[model samples]
Target: MKVRAATEADLPAILAIYNHAVVHSTCTADYQPQTLAQRRQWFDVRVQAKLPVLVAVGEGGVVAGWASLNPFKERAGYRFTVENSVYIHPERRGQGIGKLLLEPLIAEARALGMHVIIAGIDSENAASIRLHERFGFRNVGHLPQVIYKFDRWLDVVYLQLSM
Candidate 1:
């Protein structure tokens, strides 16, 4: 597998993975599937801001997973901090795709002079939490019952990694 920057051609695969998680899992809190146009806008914004959006290409040039470093907040005070996102193709989970996508993401953030990287994961997602922990991300906050989805409340665990 190869890890590299994402391109326009990878958007469909990226969108599919994200939408699958949106519809079938708690990896993301969004309930509605994003339209291609919406995803395009998101990509454009990131590109314009020079944020890192990377994709992991597996055999056959398939996009197995993707990761990105997004602005933590609009406030200038948060400029040095970024929020990290990783999404694996549902069928490709457990193949170390997340790990493959994340290592370089951290490096990319640090390369960009980011002060810290944050990961907000579903509390029940042990795999994700473990993945972040493996990279030395420490738990700094846990918000219980903060998200309503799938007819229940979901907790969010925030992990921080100083760059």
Candidate 2:
């Protein structure tokens, strides 16, 4: 697998992976599938903000997973922090693609002078929690029933790694 900054050509694959998680999993709280236009806007915002958006490509040049660092908040006080996101193709999980996508993203965050990288994960996602822990992210807090999706209440777990 190879990991690098995302290109425009990678957006469709990223969108597919992301929307799949949104529609079928608790990994993301967004219940509606995001459109290509929305994903394009997302990419534009990250570019405008000078944030990192990375992708992992497997054999045949398919995007196996992706990761990004987005502004934690618009307020000045939050400028030093970024929220991290990672998504892998459903069939590509358990092959360390998530980790491959994330490690470079974290490094990019540090290189960009970000002080903290935060991850908001579904409390039930043990794999994600463990992934964050392995990367030295500390569990900061938990918000109970912060989201209602797929006819169920979902808890959110916050993890942070100080860079």
Candidate 3:
């Protein structure tokens, strides 16, 4: 698989990947599927901010996963700090697509002069937590039972990597 910057054409696949996680997994706490327009707007905002949105294209040019570096907070004080997000196609998890996506995402963050990259993982998502740890992200904080999803309280673990 090859990882590259996401294009407008990749939005549908990106949306599908995210909505799947929203409805079927604890990867995200969102309970409803997002609309295509919402995804479009999100892409626009990221582009306008000069942030990187990358996609992992596997065989047959299908998007296997995606990763991005987003502003950690709207405040200017957080400009140098970014949050990283990675989502893989449900059918293709455990095949290293995330590893492929993350390496470049971190490179992009550093290239952009970012000071730190943050990852907020669900406490139950050991796989994701391990992935961040492997990327040199250290556990910085954990919020216990801070989210409710799938009829259960969920904890959020925050990890940080200093660039």
| TM-score for each model | 0.98, 0.98, 0.98
Q: How much lDDT does each candidate structure score?
A: 0.94, 0.92, 0.94
Q: How does candidate 1 score on lDDT?
A: 0.94
Across 27-119, the per-residue lDDT of candidate 1 in tens digits comes to 799999999999999999899989999999988999999999998999999999999999988888898989999999999898889999999
How displaced is residue 32 in candidate 3, in Å?
0.3
User: How would you order the candidates by TM-score, starting with the best?
Assistant: 3, 1, 2
Q: Candidate 2: where is the Cα deviation over 4 Å?
A: none
Can you tell me which runs of candidate 3 are displaced by over 4 Å? none
Candidate 3 RMSD computed on C-alpha atoms after optimal superposition onto the true structure: 0.6
Q: What RMSD value applies to candidate 2?
A: 0.7
Supply candidate 2's per-residue lDDT for 44.
96
Candidate 3 least-lDDT 10 residues: 93-102
Worst 10 residues of 2 by lDDT: 94-103
Quantify how close model 1 is to the true structure by its C-alpha RMSD in Å.
0.7
